[model samples]
Target chain A: MKKFMNDPETFIEDSLKGFALAHADICDVTLNPSVVTRKSLRREKVGLVSGGGSGHEPMHSGFVGKGMLDAACPGQIFTSPTPDQMMEAARLVDTGAGVLFIVKNYSGDRMNFEMAAEMSENKVAMVVVDDDVAVEDSTHTTGRRGVAGTVIVEKLVGSLAESGANLEACVAFAERITGSIASMGVAFSSCTVPAAGRPTFQLADDEMEFGVGIHGEPGRRREKIAPTDEIVAMLLDSICEELKPSSGSEVLLLVNGLGSTPLSELYLVMNSASKWLNRREVAVARSLVGDYTTALEMAGISLTLCKLDEEMKIHWDAPVHTAALRW
Target chain B: MKKFMNDPETFIEDSLKGFALAHADICDVTLNPSVVTRKSLRREKVGLVSGGGSGHEPMHSGFVGKGMLDAACPGQIFTSPTPDQMMEAARLVDTGAGVLFIVKNYSGDRMNFEMAAEMSENKVAMVVVDDDVAVEDSTHTTGRRGVAGTVIVEKLVGSLAESGANLEACVAFAERITGSIASMGVAFSSCTVPAAGRPTFQLADDEMEFGVGIHGEPGRRREKIAPTDEIVAMLLDSICEELKPSSGSEVLLLVNGLGSTPLSELYLVMNSASKWLNRREVAVARSLVGDYTTALEMAGISLTLCKLDEEMKIHWDAPVHTAALRW
Candidate 1:
């Protein structure tokens, strides 16, 4: 696999400089040998910060604006951002109103963000988003994992913070959204990291992996390419059983395209999902279909659903602004 | 090339459903087929609608919501949205305040959106963004093409619209930003469409394509990989020449990663760009780096710069809320 770069080693530093320059209204940078934090100031509003691997653009950093993260820590590629970086962001965004760390369920992310929270001087609230229903349903998995569903929790909670809701309110709102959401992903072919210069995993052309991790880690099962309906059924069955929302509950359905999957294929998956849910009489009040949280250019898609209440709907309606996510 | 979908044909449709379900606050779908429209009801606001091929997520559709597009017409993967679909969106969002079409500078996109605009109500206004410096610099091209820079124009213009600027004012602002911006892109490998199940084009292991189109089409030049500084120099030379900003003019730089390029690599390119610009005494007011407009995870990046006037900076800072972007 060929890739584009002058020198692979200098990629991160160059990208950060460009990010800071383009988003000067919202993001600033502090660079030393040690840490990188996007300016996390929301004035007198309570701040929110999140960080992890750098590959997921529009996540930690792209979200550093109003109605979202006050600051973001950039890690090296898919590796977790350093605790020191998160701590710096925590310090920068803490306006005495406090700061909330929106961490994914990944072990590395949890431990690092938690450490940063502990080291923070101002009040630090922690919310871990473990919304991947796929991991919990896998008979062999040790614990539930976080995936694209983490984005929803961040948005709901971020809006609360942007509106000057207290830190405790933001944390509770984040946790609540986390519990109500679930996600599952599959990959057709592994993405080749520019630095790695090859696909992350090997799969036959006719085979696809289900329950795959975003970073290209091995998933629970690898199987032949199934029909769209079959694939959607399997993914939904796992997610539905995990969340077990009642029939009358309003659900926000997400048919997320993994990095390389085309929107056409994603829409087909959504068709299947809508049909299946309709058959079950599940009321989907609203739906989002796009590449919200991506896994490089992996050719796959994930399904995320947030069972909604009145409050969740209101929260969802609130305005939001970030580089990649706007509403 | 391995891909994730069970069937390549279904990728776009499946992805759209998920996208619609993922973020419901700013977007909703029309059932007969699939068209995403904004939920924010600003009755007197000029509705902006954008759409094209499906591969460039967070582009036409992801940008639908308040402070940006009022609706997004999604077409099949890599194909322009149908004129009929565009007409439908044009009709739905036009609430007497008239409608504006923000189209990219692609032959298919230009023709389709133009046809749609003509077919729709005469009150609709249309603007085509042609801002890619690479396409313009190549005399062989028909006209300067639009790429990621179109997004900046959309955001800046959209914010102006949301701030209650009239259609003429918004269109004028968009035109100015478009005039001030320049972009160039390079790719290492061709992206494989899921249905095609192969690379879009072939690349030798050490080769890179410079001045490539957004769909991984062949670039203006194919050469062996070089150092990061040299690469940055090449891109900056093109952009700097195209945008002859007055001495001491402020700039907003965007270094965008094509799908699979790592953020680390993007940052490296940004750093090189900054040093190069600083040596020339260009004032960098803002910088944005990440995967804004992607080509199905192609391992490459593009650089876009907007010469900022005070008004442009204010417009850029105006709040926006869209499904895939919020600021």
Candidate 2:
């Protein structure tokens, strides 16, 4: 495969090593069970931890720092992390206020994080995010798959936790974010796992996958490639349909690039979504555009709309210091 | 060409519209002769302006904000922006303290920026960046081509300008940065300009273009893909040879992605480079990694090294708030 890595077996380890070294001021990497923890833990504050498969980077790991995730456990590419990884991460970042696990809605992730929370000696709470509105079930998930909206949930809840919220309050805010956000993705091409050494799926030059998952899982349907406006409308339609915000409601719109999509394209998608929302009299209160969550070298874009309240807006604007995100 | 664009002719405009919308808090986009200028100009500070072909995104435009560029002019994809665009940007951002034009060493860009400076009424100084050590002359340039190092020049010089340096001092610091930094890129696959509807060039499955330019210009040679360590060594060797940094010298290292390469891969490259630099006893005082400057969707990585002084280190740590970068 045409990837910048040494061995498929050691891909995650190698990347984690680099990640820790690059952001040495923010976080540290612990090998054996594989966990990324904040360099400095805030005393008596809720510890926020998140994790999942490896390929969708800057997601769990890059989010580990002040005002975001306190620890992250990464699994093999497109594979869920073991329960031990999560427990170890909890052990590292658990202040007296306890640890709150932000688990995405995937069967493996849900099961493993639950086990980790149960096994932890420290007070622990879990908030499962199932924000993707693409489908009811998918290859790795039993219900709606958590997608780009996970980033939004992480940011808002992390901010709340950093503000010295208790574990119970952090979990409530995390759940509130999960309920308010909706995401859907479209792929022009599929990404390959390094070990697999080939694309997970294929699309004709003129075909596109709608509502695709982060792991190249099947979406709602496959259709001919459409213009930017039409594709954006389709994704946003799905999101707005699920969330059903009133005409005067406000939202934080996120245009996320899946690995290989250009920032220009992601912004174009954002423009289209904003225009679409404006027509319905929905206000875009805040916006984020770039590659926050990705599926390896997949060429795709995901649109997330989070119905925002004053609390969400305030915390979203709060300071954050992380590798992939900061303000 | 599986790109998420409406029409090739309107790609840049659409993207810019979205960019202006998403970052309305930081910058404004002017359409006719496109220019992205800071939302609030810091009056009397030397205005830092940079521009180039559109594809290397988050470069000229995304860098326009506080503690960075005051303005950026974006041309059509892979083509130099017009003199009018540059002149308009200078007109918009110049606040009595004169404008400093940071031009990459591309023939077309140099000519257009020079013409813009000459025609404009505002006092202007230019620093042409030719940081690439790949070749003495290349397709788009007479001297070495400026690649990722332009970001370094803009960051350092931009910081100096933001710190209220005089136009002359800013120009001197820009020149110092232009001379101290060196960069080289390698491409695993070619990128397609939307209008072209085809890849810039083709490569066999196992081959890679070493010392490639940001525009997919021919590099030193095509060779079979090598291990990550070997590739990192070759790139760092060329940079060190040209820069000839002493063993104890401290430098800022930037591992930049060429649009489509994954962040994991970029961080892996950083890990390898850090190891290589440590072996030589050269200190990596500061590190920046990710897709800062990118060719639309080229799958490659570029390494940039800037020998650092205490002054540069202090300014490098200065706060910058831009779409693609912040601290």
Model 2 chain A: ten consecutive residues of lowest lDDT: A5-14
**Native contacts, share recovered per candidate:** 0.52, 0.74
TM-score of chain A of 2: 0.99
lDDT per residue as tens, model 2, A1-327? 899988877788888899988999999999999999999999998988999998888898999999999999999998899999999988888878999888889999999999988998978899888888999989998989988899998999889988888888887888888889999999999998999999999999889999999999999999999999999889888999999999999999999999999888888888888899999999999999999889999999999999999999999999999998899
> Could you estimate the TM-score for every candidate?
0.80, 0.99
Task: Report the C-alpha lDDT of model 1 over A191-281, residue by residue, as the tens digit.
Answer: 7776898888899977888888778777778988887788888899988988887876678888877665654456567778888888888
DockQ comparisons of all candidates to the true complex: 0.37, 0.83
**Could you give the DockQ of candidate 2?**
0.83
User: For residues B30-85, could you state the per-residue lDDT of candidate 2 as single tens digits?
Assistant: 99989999999988988889999998888888999999999999999989999999
Steric clash count of candidate 1: 72
Number of the predicted model whose lDDT against the real structure is largest: 2
Alpha carbon lDDT of each predicted model: 0.75, 0.91
Q: How far is candidate 2 from the true structure (C-alpha RMSD, Å)?
A: 0.9
